[model samples]
Target: MTTTSTDLDAEALDLLRALTGRADAVFHDGQLEAIRALVDDRRRALVVQRTGWGKSAVYFIATLLIRRRGAGPTLLVSPLLALMRDQVAAAARAGVRAAAVNSANAHEWGDVQRQIAQGQVDVLLVSPERLNNPRFRDEQMPELMRTMGMLVVDEAHCISDWGHDFRPDYRRLAELIRTLPGEIPVLATTATANERVVADVEEQLGSGTPVLTIRGSLARASLRLGVLTLPTSRERLGWLLSHLVSLPGSGIIYTLTVSAADDTARLLREAGHEVAAYSGRTDPEEREVLEQRLKTNDLKALVATSALGMGFDKPDLGFVVHLGAPSSPVAYYQQIGRAGRATDNADVLLLPGREDADIWQYFATASMPSESRAKAVLAELSGTPLSTPALEARVDLKRTPLELMLKVLDVDGAVQKVQGGWVSTGLAWRYDRERYERIAAARVAEQDSMLRYESATTCRMQLLQADLDDPAAAPCGRCDICAGVWYPTDVASEAAGRATTALDRVGVEVEPRAQWPAGADRAGVSLTGKIPPEERVESGRALARLTDLGWGTTLREVFAAGSPDAPLSRGLLDGCVRVLKEWPWAERPTAVVAMPSTSHPELVSSLAEALSSVGRLTLLPPLTATGPGSTTGRARGGANSVYRLADVWQAFEVSPSLAEALAGQSGPVLLVDDLVDSRWSLTVAGRALRRAGAPAVLPFALALVG
Candidate 1:
């Protein structure tokens, strides 16, 4: 029953025609070779091609040919939910039966399992996170692994620590692949991997088997790449406003932050453009709707963050514009690859911003947990199981970092998550200090390369390809440097004014803490349950968020470490006045009180004095910090609410004179501070004022940390 190479080639071509619905469709240079390695030779293969190079076709065709000879279902490990949906549809079009089990489709998992047991499903797709689920790992994965005909790792670059978007969950694949029988063929594919990432992935995949690496040219002839250096964020927004319509067709507008995506989308809609915002915070249903809208050309663009980066298929997407540069050239290349996939001419532009570096630094360190924090987490879980919130109360780590650390531990076989919660497995684990340090250093180097890409004199596409280690990279003749400037360099004054107005309209409602954090009593605090609506402050306002596009730059410069703490400027005073003018509170403040500030005492005192003079109200003596050391230091910012509250509970004390003075006030008192981050400071301080007989407390700040 052995099939000859010539027969296999003819069958693959026929399947490709069915997959693409084009009679003349032919495999790209390396696509057929990759498929042959997996199907005919039964060898491990890794395919690195550009976005539009038909990587999925290789796996789909191989799955069909293998199944025709009566092999088990193909197990595809995809990254995103949107990707699963698109892949399921594509499989159906090619006469393949595919089923997916993920968080979004939880209700259908039982049915999917039944289908797999009945031998009805030809391929099964899953997210990497599912591999660690206790029930599936114990009950289903063993059988699936034994019976799987082939293994596919889509978006394979995530498996390497050297990759820009490395996920700890992906590391689990190494163990899974190691356990597979030698006869099972395997395939890994990615469009964005450099020499380092490729080497790492190949080594992980091969383990002891030899892996054939097939890489094609990374150049996209239809894409026209360019970079526009804008001096300020406002100018970048202005450029989008003035020239977005001039771009070829519907595409994506990427931003480095979620707030920027939202703000940019709002501005674009106000200017009469059909656009919507997409981010991780978006609702699942809404995200699906937005993807469809963009696909059907119902919307001109989607202002998005990296959440929309991979596996989003729009064959004719017209352009990609960035409000701020990504941290690395690899990520930049992948994002821009979304465009010109199936079109003759598409635009790719980068509007570099000054704040891009700060954003990059924040994300770089956010993923790497400190050794002390990791030990604390392990120690807390040494005996008993605890939910995420319970663990957060016991450890000083925030929710995001704590979860990330737990995933790392889970993948390393040091912990297990069960029905009750997460528990330590009593396994000895070592903190790889050298590895994390190397990762941090690599991140800094990548940031430097991105800067070079912005300022490079040669073709922009060539710079990106060179960073990705594409050996055949050459100057693309369609780029700005080679073909002259294709995009406008000027922003109209009217459009600039409109962008200013949009970014300047700043008033984010500070939600009052409703319920007490779990395990509050463990920190020696007796408070529990709701904060009693009466004691809680109403929705308050800040002059601007430190992450806002308008005043963020100025606020960052003013609040940077070692910067001089000067008196309130006229502009700040004016902004405060405007905030007050728009206040929707039922009662205005008759008195003002300042939070204890050990860092910016001058700034807080000046702001309080200026408000007192402007409002003709009495300025109470400021509260004092009673703790020995600086409790409000920056290191405490990322602690949980319970820990943050405990740190500031005994730190602030209102003098008896000030308390007595507050007892005489008739209306609400304004509680002012230089900045508001955790809101625990304002919560505890507001409780003190309420206990002192003020009718209500209103929290106000010059800036808020988003």
Candidate 2:
């Protein structure tokens, strides 16, 4: 017999009460509708409600109700580990069993699989990347697709065959859904999807059947959004230093990059605030600990990258301060949604940086798959599967971008990933030129919208909502623009000085390459495995990173495209001198030698000349490239280790005078360059100097390309 609507409501209400631990819990406006669509009608649905609207509840409640009908377990493809943790915990509270298989819990995957086999698990939370795991894809996923009662994709905005989104791998879900039994229900949920994204998702998830799209107001009334245009990073740092404690409660401080997050957290800690840096570089177990600490309000804040964004919950998180604007207004909305979930009010502030556009452009270009790179990768592959490392040797592209392109190509049916590695499917594929261009155009538009959002004076919340295409967009009447500067503006002079000193402190250690990238020999690189200790250059230092908060701005200008080549700026020189003054080398360098640069010859010579003049170290003749590949314009040939090493190997030669100078030197030689990228130039130049008989080589650069 079919379940009645009234009976379904009663069962869903009971599950909701248990899940929320509230005796009188009722569904949000469309939550019950979403559940009924899944459990009753067994239809595919797309949910585009605001973040705190409890999208998880719909899937959890539906899973429980469907399980009561003796259906198989639900398979939840969540985007983040934090989301998985929250879902698993929420399931237990509702007396529904949930298990997870992710990188963090590899040891428990067997137990989770067994639980699922025994009909003990109601929901299985797996990340989108988990779907691509060799074992999971070839072994576990096929079985789950057959047995799973429902498939729910949370944060469905990441699903786009257009090829660039938060998780490009999420496109795999479309294919997975295609293979599922027609009777099984499928649900995709997101709060950030606009009209275009919604259409794309609907097309991907609903191939033949009409998908029920449930969208609610994207506005977050609890969020009082504002923007602060700080002139420099130091001023922004000063603002946070002075005003964090005044914010209502412990909250997140978001940054665009890992370095910024780490730097901001450090500066805040120096000011006596309890905070920690969380990013992709953060260890998996430590990320769990940090998430818990934030949930319990132990740390005053967690300065984080976008890694902490999706579905990480703290009902009372009082504020979110972005040191730099995200790439789009929709992203801004999603991040601010992390705050003010259960509270009547929460602060959302943006400190738009001067480098915001540059940073946005940097990330935007890397994400979209390039047509030429795709062809290059495809050309290098045959019918046989080749490991990623082996392919890296054959292709000039770097590992990360190459992997990302291959994933998109795999989804597009041009390639397939197997147990060994990846193989070309020999299926004729056409590059979606128009689709990629449109996607790029959309990103540009979104970025432009973000710029307007920052400067708009009418209403901050309404502008953000409108950017997300919310029909209910209206003036919040509470933001700094709507109201008048409610947040603290002035940074104390002492705080500014403290921030200046903290952010400006230079000297990033450039660790020497320890081992040659695998498959180097295939590219004609003689080096492989660990470098001989005697031939390796010692750990070196640069004035600062081009992406750093302090001197990075100046260095970026110095090295920006089309910028004129000039001697080192006094500011950078001062920072470099400071690095040298505090240098922790085993012994002071007795000689200074400049690494030849076609890009910034004056800058390199001036740095070497000044350092030697200031320190009274022996000045040695510089080495210059004169071989066949020396005309490769920029010194670094390729991004990957194999190509870079091959391009620079025996590329630079030591002059007689330089060899004589090195032979005469009784101490380490200082090798200065304009910038350090790939580090192959330094390794090659330093090896030449060491062979010519310098006791040690201490490499230094004006900036590191981190």
Candidate 3:
């Protein structure tokens, strides 16, 4: 029986009351319409509303209403663990039973499965990556699909390759959507999609049926936006240190790199602010704790990367600050949307950095797979399954790129993951070169738009809105340009000094390799299993990491392509001296030796000679490359440990004079190099020195690549 509009209105009122715990609660402009489309019309719809616009409420309310009519469970494909937690809590308030199956809750899978089979679960949330799990894909997914009443895709922008933060796993949704019954309602939602992305997503969801696209204005009246172009990283850090306390309430400070996030959090703590760092490397349980702390106003801020981007909820968060600009305005808009959600007059600030472009380039190239590498991986897979490590041995690609390529191939139907590992499916897959090229071009364009945003004379908010193709965008009268700067421009001298000191601190510990990589023996190296502790060099020191806030800027200039070889600067020499002065070794080094440098011989020689002169130690002849491949120039960083070991093993030879000098040394020997990347060079070089009768070897370098 068809329900009357008055009856639907009454039911919506009840859902709103149950969700917000207020009898007078009401829907926003289009919230009730969206809920009715899903619950009454059973239509596939895409909602492009801003953050905190009650998107979750629409879905949860629809789930409850559908379940009341005795429909099957609603299945939601959420992108983040944090989002799942928030959605589950929201569903419970609306009296809809929701359960989640993700990586963090492995032990509860059986209970969740049983609950679903018994019709106790009204909604089930799973991550996009979980859809590719072997057991779930082959066994549980079919059952869920057979009885699913509605399907919702949160963070739907990820489904399009043209989107800024696209993931290969999300593309699997297209195939899943195609199999769904026509009557089953489907909803896709996101806050940051341009015309291009919206069209791409609509096409993916079509499956020969029309989709209801509900796009609203992208403007946020509660957010006041501004951009500060800091000339140096230390200045940016100084600004944050001096100004974070003056912000309205607890919030988030976003950084582009993990090192920057950690460094910023440490400096802020030193400044007596209660802050924590959040990133992809953070432990899952600790992330939950941190999220809870933020929700309850226990932390002043979380220095985070994009890992905390979507679905993190704190309704009254007072500010959002960016330590460096993201690659696109769409991403920046999404991040800043976290603030001013449930409150008025939240501050949004962007401290654009000079190194942002370089960081952006690194990440952009890392995401694109090389055609040769992808083909090589497919060639190696056969009837027999091979693990990632085994595949890494056969293919020269590194671990991260290999895994990402496998994900893409899996979605393309070229491979299947089984109990043992991955195997080819005998399906012919064509490389979509034109599509990839177009995506790369689009990314570049987006980056240029972000740059424009930093320098726009008009409203900053409008620029972002324009980038997202919002037709209703206009001057947001609260921006720095719309109204003159309302924030303090002066950074306290003491705060600047503190930031400089923190950035200038050197000496990062380089942990020695503990074991040979799994497939080392198969790659013509005899070594296997654990590396003997005795043969390993002690944990060493580098003057700075290539990613450090202070030295990073200077080092990038020095290491740029075609940079002339030169001796160490006085500042660098002082840094190296400080590292030596703070050394906590058991015995002072009696001798010094340099690693062979095909590219910067003069720099290496001058560094070793200078250290020897200052420490009053004998300077031994430098080591030399033994074979043709020994001096293959500089090995680019980011290769897996197995490939790095194979590239360096037997590649270096100890000079006779160096061996003689090692034999005469009574205490430890200092092994100096220009840089340490994979640490394989230090490992093999130190091993050679040890075999030459040196009692101990201590590795030191000018820089460490992160």
Q: Give model 1's TM-score versus the native structure.
A: 0.98
Write model 2 residue lDDT over 487-562, tens digit each, in one string: 9899989889989999878899988976777877877876678877777898999998888888888888898879
By how many angstroms RMSD does model 3 differ from the true structure?
1.5
Whole-structure CA lDDT of model 1: 0.88
By TM-score, is 1 or 2 better?
1
TM-score of each: 0.98, 0.97, 0.98
- Which scores greater on lDDT, model 2 or model 3? 3
Model 2 residue pairs with clashes: none
Cα displacement (Å) at residue 699, model 2 = 0.4
Error of 1 at 251 (Å): 1.0
* Candidate 1, 97-213: lDDT as tens digits: 999988998898889888988999988999999988877777778879878999999999999999888599999998899989988999999999999999999999999899999
